[model samples]
Target: MNFQQRKNKILAQLASRGEVDTRELAMALDTSEITIRRDLNRLSDEGQLYRTHGGAIPVDQPPLPFEFTQKATANQSAKDNICRQAAALINDGDIIFMDCGSTVFRLCQFIKNRKIKVITNSMPVIQALQNTAVSLNIIGGEYDAARQAIHGSMAIEHIARYQAHKAFIGADGLSAKGLFAHSEKEADMALALAHHSHITYLLCDAAKINKPSYLHFAPLETVQTIITDAALGQLSYCKKKGVKVITV
Candidate 1:
């Protein structure tokens, strides 16, 4: 089979299964693993698929918003590792802003014992840190049932009332253009948090890098640092943009 034919087969598999492994595709197509990787890279650059560590997943034109439970399970290990790294950056008596991103929610588990203040709109983060020594400041606004979080003009106003030492956020997609999200409300909240904090850290898994989403919140330069899994391959691009890329 030719290059185009192999790519078409890979796309077909991605469409049916939602994801495809490099080695598995190589075996099935009777091609070398290197060739499969090249095809995946090409397809990913074309925005047809999203390349992962050893595989690729179909790209959603306008990324879908995942529920709290669904996001908690997807890439759980990667999220845990990233959160651990982020948790270490916190100091005692520091005030922090936590966004309602699922990956940011994982940081709550690792930092529940810390003696720091947490201002957030995430119900999950509030629940996770309620019994801990961490001080909780919940942002009040209209509740979003689908996201299980609070967001609106009031939430933005509430966030602006306080400043933080650091703000940790998550995005549906990250590219050279900036951070992207499926919901405009979430984007507005993230922007507010970024503006109110001294430093901003973007917490996301490798799969989200270079993936495009519906709403562009802010540019890569807006955040001080980006914490992600080691599978991300855009370090050069990030470095060129003057954004610190921390791979856990």
Candidate 2:
């Protein structure tokens, strides 16, 4: 097929599957991987799609802050898989910081039976574990009604006052520049938690691997490990910066 024909096919795949990987697209089109990469790059530059670690996702408007209830059900399966892996990393009597992201909230289900202390700003997470044996500490801050979470200078100060064995946070997108969030306050809260914890874990689904967001919260080195449902080519870049990845 001609160059334009190849590019069109890539776009069609992204539209149908929401994402297109370089290797997979090359094999499907009977083209070299290098040619596929070039097509993806061109498409990205033209704003036709958003380039990811090993693939590209359909192009759309910039992301906005999503409501907790809305996001909790958006990618339930991937979030569940990621949460299961995160819960296995927890042990009895451990203290952890859980962010307000939906993926982090899913961890509550697996960890409810464990004897662990959780420090969080997420109202949903608090509600999820309210009947469990786990100890909970809610951060004090100005509440964000849209996000159903707490954030502000008060929340950041509260996070810094305590240290945890681990901190599990979520991101809207992950690129070579680092983790991205939709809101500055949310990013601030995540950064504070990562700083005060012994180990920071970024819990994200495959859809978030190469997405873009307005706020660049922290570099990949800010977190000690990344927990996800798919392999990310960018993991190599993160490894060189001393960040480990756990793909479930």
lDDT of each: 0.85, 0.83
Model 1: residues with Cα > 4 Å off, grouped in runs: 1-66
lDDT (Cα, tens digit) per residue for candidate 2, span 124-236: 78766765689999999899878879999999999889999999999999977899999998899899999999999999898888777998878989998999886867466
Clashing pairs in 2: none
TM-score per prediction, in order, is: 0.72, 0.72
lDDT of 1 at 169: 94
lDDT of 2 at 43: 86
TM-score of structure candidate 2? 0.72
Model 2 weakest lDDT span, ten residues long: 61-70
